[model samples]
Target: MFVPFLIMLREGLEAALIVSLIASYLKRTQRTQWFGAMWAGVFIAAGLCLALGIFINQTTGEFPQKQQELFEGIVAVIAVLILTYMVFWMRKVARNVKAELEDAVDQALQKGANSGWPLVLMVFLAVAREGLESVFFLLAAFTQDVGYAPPIGAMLGLATAVVLGALLYVGGVRLNLAKFFKWTSLFILFVAAGLAAGAIRAFHEAGLWNSFQAVAFDLSNVLSTQTVFGTLLEGILGYQEAPTVSEVAVYLIYLIPALLLFLMPARPAASATKDAREASSARR
Candidate 1:
């Protein structure tokens, strides 16, 4: 539940930031009349994401047990891959995101009053990317365990992000977004690792993976998965009382290198920080 909460928080914040930037640009340029187009794009993107997520969920539910495991395993792997790429991609591209978005807004507005397609398309694509990413991650998260907590957590996270975005836009609050993302990225890395392990376990259950079937360790006596605390750990951290060798191997392989790369310093990061701070200030 906590993992899903953070995932939604991060993804929702990204979408909110995009929409906030577009709205800020529109207001600053005295083009408030075109606000309808911006909102249309946001709604369309959100609706599409919701539809896609629901369709995926419903389709997977009709499968047989073995097929269900296979499908879940595949989706989990895809989610982890996408999550890992997303984290690194954001690290690489976040600095330029503000300027690029502003540039896109300028282009969209330059097209003028004859049609709102330019602005609408721009905002739709921007928001849709974040929305779809969230959908896939959430689907994988929901597949991991049986419960209502993850979805509830996700809803709360999104609501909080919307509020935060509003506060930022209204100049009611200031945040060091760079630091926030850095810390969150670290947490997300662990979450993705857990997801990967779960995927391996799922594959094993589906009979698609047989190697390394040996139990690396068993803690069921002390930490039974049926317990509330154990369930929480399993849901959030992919904790298994008796983890198979392959699961542990995959977890370590993904987390260690991913963390190393994520924590490594980038060249000339100070300038990027300056640009991000300037952009954040301008959004107000």
Candidate 2:
């Protein structure tokens, strides 16, 4: 439940940010007439994502047990990849996202009256990117646990994000977006690592992976997954009571380096500019 909530919150916030930015830009340029087209794009993209998620989830349910496991494993892997890429991508672009978005809006509106369709397309693509990411992630998360908690949590998270986004756009809230993203990125890395481990476990269950099958350790005696604390850990961090060697290895291999890289301070813009100037001078 917590896992789904947090993931949805982060994902929703990202989509909200994109929408808010686009709307803000349109208003600032006194092109508020395009607001209708912008909203149409958002709704269309959202509908597409919803339909796709339902279709995939329903289709997978009809598969045989082994096939289901295989599907789960594949989804988990894809989710990990997408989550990692998004985390790093957001980090890289956080500083310039506003400017980039404004530029994109300018390009979209360059067609004058015909710009309506182009702006719609631009917003549609942007929102759909985030929506698709959320869909994949939610699918992966749902595969791990059964029941109503995950879905409920996701809905609540998304609702909260909408409220927050509205507040932000109205200048009613002032959030430290950089810190928020940075901390969430760390949490997401952990979640992705867990997904990586879960992927290995799922593959093994599907009979596709048999290497390094030896038991790494047995925590079932000390902390069974059936317990409250254990369940929380399993849901959030992909804790395993009796994980195999492959699962443990994959978890550490992904988590360790990911953490290191994420925590490493980014090169300052000033330093980068200085280096660029030096190179240009040498070339001259």
Candidate 3:
């Protein structure tokens, strides 16, 4: 439940922020007439995401047990890749996202042919990218746990994101986006590590991976995943009471390096700019 909630919250806010940035740019540029087309794109992209998610979820349920496990493993792997890419991509672009969006809007409107369509396409592509990422992630998360809690938590997270997005657009609230993303990025890495481990377990269950099948440790007696606190940990961090050796290896192999790289301080913009200027001077 907590896993889905946090994932959905982060994903939904990303999409919302993109939409708001585009909208804000359009309004500032006196392109309010294009608002209708922009909104059309958003709604269409959202509907497509919803429909696709439902279709995938419904169809996957009919597979045989082994095949189902294989499919889950495949989905989990894809979700982890997408989630990792998203975290780093946002980290790279968050500072310049507004400028990038404004430039995109300008290019869209400047196109001589079918200007409105370009803007619509731009908005659609941006939102759809985020939506698709969320869909794959939610599918992986839902497959791991059964019952209404995850779904309900996801919906609540999305609702909160929408309200927050609105507040931001209206200047009703202010947030330190840098800090927010930093904390959330750390949380997401933990989730992705768990998914990586879970994917290995799923592959083993599907009879695809057999090596290193030895149990890493047995904690079921002390901290069974079925218990309340254990369930919370399982949901949030992919805790397993008796994980296999391969699962433990995969978890640490992904998590440790990911954390080190993420925590390493990024090069300052001023330093980067100075280096670029030095290179240009040498070339001249």
lDDT of 1 by residue, 39-68 (tens): 999999999999999999998898999899
Q: Higher-lDDT candidate among 1 and 2?
A: 2
Q: Which stretches of candidate 2 lie over 4 Å from their true place?
A: 268-284
Give the alpha carbon lDDT tens digit for every residue of 1-284 in model 2.
88788888888898899899889878876889999999999999999999999999998898999999999999999999999998998888787666667666776778655658888898899889889999999999999988999999999889988988999899999999999999999999999999999999999999999999999999998999999999999999999999999999999999999999998888555555455445433433
Model 3, residue 217: distance off in Å is 1.0
Give the per-residue lDDT of model 3 (tens digit) for 10-81. Answer: 888888888888888677767788998889889989999999999999998999999999999999999999
RMSD of 2: 4.9
| Residue ranges of candidate 1 with Cα displaced over 4 Å | 111-113, 269-284
lDDT of 1: 0.87
Clash pairs detected, candidate 1: none
Cα shift from native, residue 35, model 1 (Å): 1.5
Whole-model Cα lDDT of every candidate shown, in order: 0.87, 0.89, 0.87
TM-scores of the models, in the order given:
0.91, 0.93, 0.93
**Would you list the rank order by lDDT, best first?**
2, 3, 1
Pairs that clash in candidate 3 = none
Highest lDDT model number: 2
- Separate clash counts for every candidate: 0, 0, 0
